[model samples]
Target: MTKALKASGFLGLATMMAVGLHQFVILSGGNPVPPWMIGGHAHLGVLSILAIVMGFAVPALGVTGQLRTAVTVLYIAGQWGIPGIVWLGEGFGLTFLMPTGFLWGLALIASMLIMFYVTITGDGDAGDRGPTATAPADD
Candidate 1:
């Protein structure tokens, strides 16, 4: 699961960069796209964790199932599928959705990276070693 998460993070980041760049172009008036339409479009990229956790089971208890399912939606609709739809609609002509997809994809990757980091490192990525901090009654 850790390996998978790491891999996903890399893929998601790449997607985000591409989509984000395209979105930037459209927003900067490179094409006929309007600014208003692109607004809030990048958010999809920012909140992709929900979709990323779909395949793996989160820690805790039975709650992992629900959480994973919810996460899957973002991957299916927000990160992976929506971009194509957005492009089809106005990407060719220039719209925020087109570039937004790139951002979203990048965000997805970032989320995965963050998740792995948090889960593996605990302190935002330092590697698993400090038993003194986590050990229960070992003292």
Candidate 2:
């Protein structure tokens, strides 16, 4: 899962860079930036960074096995799907794709909720922080 997340992160970064350069070219040509391009560029860059961070944090959060697999898949799908759909829908003026993109975003949010639940409930011992340092010492 970690490798998958990191691979996705790097891939996303590469893709985002290409988009960014495309945006630069558009601006350099004195053409107004398309709204879809701006949206795609921002989402791709931010989500790519989140993917990299989640790669490290997931393990520390003790998410493992099948559940981890599910989360990873959902995260990757949302990370790319949302913006990709935006590019398709807005760039090509096919607004029908917006609902599908919204679904993708919801999936991403669901995965986040699962992570939050796991963290608060302490579902695994992998990330046990042990006793709090602020606890009063025995007399």
Candidate 3:
């Protein structure tokens, strides 16, 4: 979990750098930047921070292995892959990756679902019971 959090934080820093680079490109060029590039850059910058926070929170969520893996993959895609695809597409003026937008959307949705489930279910502590429930005491 600690490693995951560190990884997320590093990604967030990288995303911030990307955003700065995007701004530099726009400001340095007389030509206008594309709206998709701007939007993608902004979203990635914000979502990267969210990913880091989520990474820190997820360990307490007690998610199953499969669900944890899903969350990690989807979060990474949302935080990194979407913006990267946009950067490449815009840089090369290629539309081949446009269809991947759907995948990015799915990744966002999956991450949200995992968070919602964890929040609602008390961090996946299945063995935990309320005050009215008690475990047997060892003598």
Task: Tell me, by lDDT, which candidate is best.
Answer: 2
Show the lowest summed lDDT stretch of 10 residues, model 1.
55-64
List runs of model 2 lying over 4 Å from the truth. 123-125, 128-139
Q: List the residue pairs that clash in candidate 2.
A: none
- The TM-scores of all predictions, comma-separated, are 0.36, 0.86, 0.70
Ranking by lDDT: 2, 3, 1
Clashes of 1: 10
Query: 1-139, model 1: which lDDT tens digit per residue?
Result: 3334434545655666676677778768857544433533453354334334433333321223444444443344445445454545464665544666665566456545544544664543233234323444666
Clashes of each: 10, 0, 0
Candidate 3 per-residue C-alpha lDDT over 11-95 given as tens digits, one digit per residue, 9 for 90 to 100: 7678677777877788798777677677677777777777777776566555657777778878877777677677767656777
- After superposition, candidate 3 runs with Cα above 4 Å error: 25-34, 123-139
lDDT of the candidates, in the order given: 0.47, 0.86, 0.71
Give the higher-lDDT candidate: 1 or 2: 2
Better structure of 2 and 3 per TM-score? 2
Q: Please write out the lDDT profile of model 2 over residues 1-139, one tens digit for every residue.
A: 9788888999999999998898899999999999889999899889989999889778878788877987899999999998899998999888988889878898799778878877888755555554422445699
Model 2 scores a C-alpha lDDT of: 0.86
